[model samples]
Target: MAGTPTIFLHAELLPNIRQLTLHVSLPNSASEIDIRESTITLSESCRAVTVFTLHQDVELVETLKLPVKVTDASRRNLSFAGHRVDIGGTESKAQTAEYSFRLQVDPNDAGLTFTNKGFQEDDYVPWTASDMSTCAALHCKFCKQMIVDVASKPDTSSWQWKDLPSGNWAEMMDFWHCHKPDVHPDDKEGQKDIEAQNASVKGYGASNRVVATPRTGLVDVASFLVAESDCQNIKVLEQRPTSTSAKPASHDGKNARNIGCSGCSAIIGTEDSVAEGLRLYKNNIVVKHTGATEHVYETHSIDIITSSRFLDLIDHEGVRRFVIHAGQSNGILLWAFNPDLRYSSSSADHSIVSRRAMKVLYQNATDVERILEPENGVPTPLSLEELFLPENIYDELVLSLRRSNLLMPISARIFREWNVALLDRIEKRP
Candidate 1:
């Protein structure tokens, strides 16, 4: 028997174009391999692609299976047009070579009977206020200390969990909720005062300000905005600004400080200087809901939590490109290419289970101002939002991006100046 060949395969189906693209990496020289002698087979019965290489030392055959049947974006079954696949290009480096191939596909004939639909979306729900029980207790994930003890209250029903508006709520309000001020034309001072009042009210308005009130835990997309008095076993430490870093500022334009778990001394979140509350990060703490058979906690990595928030921001703000700054020197330029994609890799152990991912084009941006110029024939001015992230969260996100970059073949790693990678959005939590 021939030994298994060291090969890696990545396949992407483009239903819109009726094409399937494949990238195959093998530990051999391109000159030694005869592309004409190799053959590819697409079996609808098994929903897999089998590749045969006859030019190698020993005949090698490998099959890449799909979790779901091949289907178009609209769930219509797609059949292979022909078994012949065209090699687009090949790149050889050192002792390894990567081959790119494209195959044509067509929609199934209406007369033919087919009973395979593509796999549905994952069976996990994104975090929201409804997912949290009224009597939930928030505890530090590191130390397991109860930070917000709402379950201990006699009447938990009184406490409300109100979801805050999206990060770009102020911009949306300017377009949808704008109204002319009612002030006399003669008094300019009165008009100015009225305009200021309309732009920002005490706790709500057109400014990017979300206020937290008593007895209410304001929920953002990724964190909880709770009153400082409601938090226990936590300490606030002053964050001094450095030369390369700007002074830490909260959403409400006040000097911000670090909020840490007193028991473990882990930085959980930041203090809300304006609202006088603790913005507890969801990934840093665990929540115990009411009426559970066992102690169930939903925990996520910083990258996963950050990616979910990015999805929300895209849905609400409709902005795909963003400049995220951790400090004056550390920054990342993110252009979300595809928010949803289904992919499978031969390198993974569970290749049968296709994963959901977000395709992104990223670049390390030390000087954000320099990269803001137009590139790739962008007609209109670029619309980018500056995101000020905590240093720890920024580091995690960068690490996640780099780790995923290694999973791709060298040819697909970079797109011009941006590095191409996929961020897996696997959600198993109910």
Candidate 2:
């Protein structure tokens, strides 16, 4: 629709209400095309839709077929209605026509049944909860260099893998210990002394401190925190102060450094000085399980890993807004519209039976330094979680967001400065 001479179809089935929302984008304006004669064929086995348009210069026909097979109970219950076709866009050069309709199931169909295989709770495994046996070996995805061999640890008898409670574990501890309700308001000096004494005795209120034990690997939503003595073939870059980070300091106090793969010099994670260990990103390393055969290793893409992190953030913090900063001038303002949804697109792969995804509204914040400042333009200070990512990972996230637009209808791809897209949820294997 956006100057391309191709058709795009997007379909979203709302199984809860037994309805399907459909959108079809055309290459020409509404005046130049006609769809009164178009046809849709629906059966228990498949769905086929055909569009025929006649213009003064040319005549075109296109068809979209969905490979979904339904039960016989739904064969006689589904229908399409409430059709709307019109032109969309602000400028003439970008204007295009789109057709939209809803396929509904009859309210009287009591015997109707739907397949819900991929939408189960267990399928949405968080990255922090991902399976990792004590015997597994961590390898760099880029160079295949072994970073940590769990079976070879000096204390194999005590070796274990444990997941952190949440991504904001340290922040929560700091808030609880520093802002205790029982502290007296009159004695400020006494409060400070009591807090310091409690911290020293219990060692439970240290901020930004993630210490990894000699025989345990601490797992968080994004990275694995492990002792430095157990790592190999990795390099830690010189620490430098971050210019655009709005979040808390890294493990290295006020400075942060990239942890790189020794073979390819590619960034795999960051150095955590507080933990005296390496925070290896999950997406950059492959995991060879204890009983893996044929040398197969489980690897996750950067986008999938990021999406899981978003879900984990939403779960723990109960917030959906995030500001991802790459540098001084560029960043992304992201809102998780719907944390989980079942979606299907005609332009996507037909082989897949079900797709679990998250709908997101993202905007490219050019003036990132002032985007959230109340004095600049924003009305008030926003409670946004901040992520300071390296340049390469930031680019990959932006690319993944933009590339997802191709799998959606043109009319629903954008809204003002915010671009609408979907980040797929990682499906766990049995």
Candidate 3:
């Protein structure tokens, strides 16, 4: 019997863009592959088939198919032996070309929703150029860092803002009641602040309490600004504590610290004082309201801003754990198992139950088993093939981490370690 070809198909969700990536890996030589000649077709069954002719000189052809829809697609060849493609139209020695297809799913699809409270909904209001100008020149009061600027208006048409719900008195009261109970000892001042905010809300509603609204292309937590250095024009300042609204503590503590603009000693936002993991605040951020009679500027908490460092990985028990340290703030930890990959089984496994377990752990050949056992030599770098997680799961992991001010871009060193591990696994295979 002819054994199955060493072809692998995998799908991953792009966390930043909320797009689906379908990748096909072929075991054929690069000189025999020409993605430009490939044709991909999608079926009503939500499956896709790709046919490409390889080694045109010999008229050799191959077909690769998977269960997915191809929307926007592109192709690139990669060689594990450190081969680079020349841009000057020079043919180079490469062995593998990876074909990536972006899937087409409705923006209103149920799969995109995060929570019942509509936290991750796509209901964003466009931000006009004038609307962004209000806070363009403003800096943090404590750090004097330039938070926003006129040049920030890259896409005035699609850029939008969304209102984040501020918890009611009951929620706020409960948070303060439990936060640092030993330190507060007595809830007298905490109770007073809750009552005061509640009274203000009751009289003026949430409008009065909302101060500033920041705009982003998306409404996810990571969409907000995280690092003071991300701002082109900014000044750093000596760290200092800044006062904030007496709201119930969310993931971070009650007081926000270390989130000041570098350009000036202005307190733009609040951050965790210790790890400085994630910072949250609304200082000098405002949006414009176009009225029928005249232009009106108001402080609204419709949009919030934040900053944090890159992601970090730790080993717990036998499983590899991933987390984002929000500097001095609390870190955001991810769940052990990915829900999407839970039902998948490894095709290489002969036993049905073991195959099912493989699907649950690795999803497909494209899925890389998170560093289950770290090897001693040079750490392998992680690739897109290894971390191709589902969109919903990936988004939640990133959003939660960002909200806690712990979200960060994966670093190159970590990727190197993942790649090294991957090569070792491939070499060890009999």
Q: Give the TM-score comparing model 2 with the true structure, all chains together.
A: 0.75
lDDT of 1 by residue, 129-198 (tens): 6666444688888878878877656665467787776666656667644574555668879867865786
**Per-candidate TM-score against the hidden true structure:** 0.73, 0.75, 0.26
C-alpha RMSD of candidate 1 = 7.0
List runs of model 2 lying over 4 Å from the truth.
1-7, 14-18, 26-37, 45-84, 87-97, 105-130, 153-155, 170-210, 238-249, 291-295, 348-350, 376-378
By summed lDDT, the worst window of 10 consecutive residues in model 2 runs over: 111-120
Among the numbered candidates, top TM-score falls to: 2
Q: List the candidate 1 regions with Cα displacement exceeding 4 Å.
A: 1-5, 15-18, 31-39, 52-62, 71-92, 104-125, 142-144, 155-159, 174-210, 213-215, 243-247, 289-296, 349-351, 369-381, 426-430
lDDT of 3 by residue, 192-271 (tens): 68757975866443334333333331122222333333344443334333122112123334444334445554434444
Judging by TM-score, tell me the better candidate of 1 and 3.
Answer: 1
Candidate 2's displacement at residue 86, Å, is 3.6
**Against the correct fold, how does model 3 do in TM-score?**
0.26
List the candidate numbers ranked by lDDT, top first.
2, 1, 3
Model 3 RMSD, rounded to 1 decimal? 23.0
